[model samples]
Target: MTIRTTHVGSLPRTQDVVDFIFARERGEAYDPDAFDAAMTGATAETVRRQVEAGIDIVSDGETSKISYATYVKDRYTGFAGDSPRNSPADLKMFPSFLERLKNDGGTPTYARPMCVGEVRSKGQGELEKDIANLKAGMEAQGVERGFMNAASPGVISLFLQNDFYPNREAYLAALADAMRDEYRTIVAAGLELQLDCPDLALSRHMLFTDLSDEEFVKVAGMHIEALNHALEGIDPARVRVHICWGNYEGPHVCDIDMDKVFSTLMGAHCRYVLFETSNPRHAHEWTVFRDRKAEIPDDKVLVPGVVDTTTNFVEHPELVAERIARFAGIVGAERVVAGSDCGFGTFAGFGAVDPEIAYAKLGALAEGARIASGRV
Candidate 1:
């Protein structure tokens, strides 16, 4: 069987698109028409490049988005004001690293929109535009299979603090209800829907660090419940859930262990599970399948990441093939889809990886998938 390959979501945005997004974010005057044109060109170009690199499933590269989850602040209503500095618990452990980063040109503080009122769909036009661009890009590249990534309710709540909601459950439910439009739109347009639920893993430290391990799982489980509610009518086969322990070049000592949340992740309603496996901190976790092989349902597809996104070092095709082969050996080849540990350009211009190197890695990933298909 052919081993399908895909990435977590965001790809490197063209310099033009990058500049436009940054300019707008900085409140600088930029031509809206030019930005729109650049987004269209970048989407088409990224899609074509993915096909050229031998990727089976492509994305719009998220060229129009500023960041993965924070972009929702622009599309939805009720997200007003900002909350406290909710820093990641892992980062707090490395005070020296934080100082070094601060000394070396600080990171951009992306908007953290709080839930000040009721959530509603004000960004449907933007989403429709994204859909149009994806369809156009697919036609231009002559590639049919594609997917669009949307933020999960849990993630939105994690990034965008909620001072308005009475409690966590109420906030998450509202976010799920608001994001349903985007999810349904992508699937209805005949593309797979990739729900980015970093909260399931990352939040264990980032936002829910105060809770015990068991308590955090229960909290994360609620997020999955809200996600299922959002995905009520969509076919699970057409949906993929991507969970990560925060996508960054951090110590990651605080990341929730994969086994700790394995059951919670599988409990997600999506049929396809996309997770990180290439990062050094979590690379060995792929063996979990061998240990808990029986728990994986027959209908589920394991899309383990074979490419690392947090570094510039390009991985060899053989290494990627070996990674995929390992998973295939435990499960079956037909049930695996090669993926990236996380997004290459998760937050628009804030990618840790170099843009050109990111594409090279994709090429390596595709080539690696081809190699594994033969061996598996």
Candidate 2:
């Protein structure tokens, strides 16, 4: 098959779903049954839109999630409602931006869930609902393959501060143990499982700015171990891993180079690696694959973001095709898949790109893949 087109999970939610989420976040009483119905409808609609845009592998738009990583708090036990608030070092460096966010009421103020007790999966029912919703959407659309995004143990640690654990290591181990059940369920449902693991690369600037390269790599290695452990008994072929240097537009000079951790990424047991490559910050880094193709396993596929998610600009189809062709030249067409740099709506109510433009970009991505396929 030629290079296929997909995107990082998450698409903009309709106004109704957004309101329901905000109501819950504000501690206002809301109807659980109503929320579930709304979520199911939204998931189905999102999937239909993805197929309409010609995406090969679609997701439920993570419509049921508040945020990609922190949504785990609701599905698992041991997390307290009162999560600590912290800012990325990059954001902290520019306090004016924070002030602007506050002024615009865009500075999300949800409590960060803390590890207040030992972690355990609430039940399979929570994830099963998602699986069922996604399956229903795929059935409705008559699509073949789809994926679901789950927060990695490491990303959970990065987003939700650990207060109860004796140390970070202890906290991460508990998270991995608890999240394994969810990981297994998705794959068992005959869907690809995409583990969102920004902690490996994004946390260096966002949360671990205080650590040195050696110390950060040590921590990152542990993070990968926890993910691998959760992925045990699951075929690597059925799983794909995504890494990014945080999804926001910021001065990413502090971000760690992919070279520093490429080996660690290649070490993941998963057979596919999806990463940010279209944005200006990491665009040039795609050459790393050409320079160091030896680091990538032959069995794995490389899904590079040829469409930028941070900006509103709808990349020209030719530009998108050009980007895909670059990677195809390096990794071979069969081993390449076109994707977005990061999620368009990384958070429920926090999308920077316009919803209409997001779909337009996806159209461009599909067109680009078609153009690249011809060339390859």
Candidate 3:
């Protein structure tokens, strides 16, 4: 039984790609043709790199996106105004550490656009370009198994505050309808659609800070409901959902426990769930899967992260094998896939891990999956 390897969407972007993305964010004029050519070259390089690193399942690396959630502002209507940035509660508690993080140039300046009008597809042509770039890259690499990421409705709602909708449900409904276009577009492109739904776990410490874990589950259920609506008619097997409690180097003391939201997350229409499993705070939570084994549908698969992305230290191949074996012990080796805790380069200019080091870590993931193939 061989363990398959994939990463959460997003690998490091080249300086030229980063410059073009930031230029669009700044509303500055640029040659659209030149940007497209640069992005295509960059994407092909990333795809070829992933294949060389021994990845089985691959992504476009989200080369065209500014950030996972905020990129929607460009494709959809209603996200035009500013939204105040709120630091995670745990981070705010340690003011000195927060200061140090900022001083270290950890914060990449980007806009958090708010929903001031109705949410609808604006016909921006970004999704189409994204699909073409990814397909071209995969074609060049002779890679057939691939996926592209789209922000889930819940996650979009979390970052882009809704000022137009009368209530949270209303806002979510609008987002679901609007984002449905992107969802279907990706699936229609003959590639798996990965829905980035960090709102499920990350919001507990960031967006819904006032609510207790129990209460937060109720709200996240609403988020999943909206996502399900957006996923209508799409095959569950063609989709994967990524959940994490914020992808940053910090004291994540207040992240909601997986036990509290595991059931709510399984309620999604997606068949595969990719989650953080090897982080310092969450490594012990593998027992959460063992404890709730009955709840996982047979058709569903688990992609547990065997590599931690925030730190620079590359995991030894043996340790990665041991971690994968732990999950296989609970759910069978056939049901598990190797993954990373989160995307190394989440935002265009904001990757904490060095680009070369990130690739080296992924290289370790491939080697480790090989090590776990039989022993599990």
| Per-candidate alpha-carbon RMSD to the true structure | 1.3, 1.4, 1.0
Each candidate structure's TM-score, on Cα atoms with residue i matched to residue i, is 0.97, 0.97, 0.98
**Worst window of 10 by summed lDDT in candidate 2:** 104-113
lDDT of 1: 0.88
Error of 1 at 238 (Å): 0.6
Clashing residue pairs in candidate 2 are: 83-112
Per-residue alpha-carbon lDDT of model 2 for 119-187, expressed as tens digits?
A: 888898867888899999999999999999999999999888888889988888888889888988999
Which one is best on TM-score?
Answer: 3
C-alpha RMSD in Å of predicted model 3 compared with the true structure: 1.0
lDDT of 3 by residue, 1-376 (tens): 8889999989999999999999999999999999999988998899999999999889889998999889998887777869878888889989999999899988777899889998889883888888888888888888888999999989988889888899999999989998888888899889999999999999889889988888899999999999999999999999999998999888899899999989988998987899998889999999999989999888778999888989999999999999988888888888898999999889997888999999999999999999999687
lDDT for residue 361 in candidate 1, whole number 0-100: 96
Candidate 1 residues lying further than 4 Å off, grouped into runs, are none
* lDDT ranking of the models: 3, 1, 2
TM-score of 1: 0.97
Error of 1 at 95 (Å): 0.6
What is each predicted model's overall lDDT from 0 to 1?
0.88, 0.88, 0.90
Q: RMSD of candidate 2 to the true fold?
A: 1.4
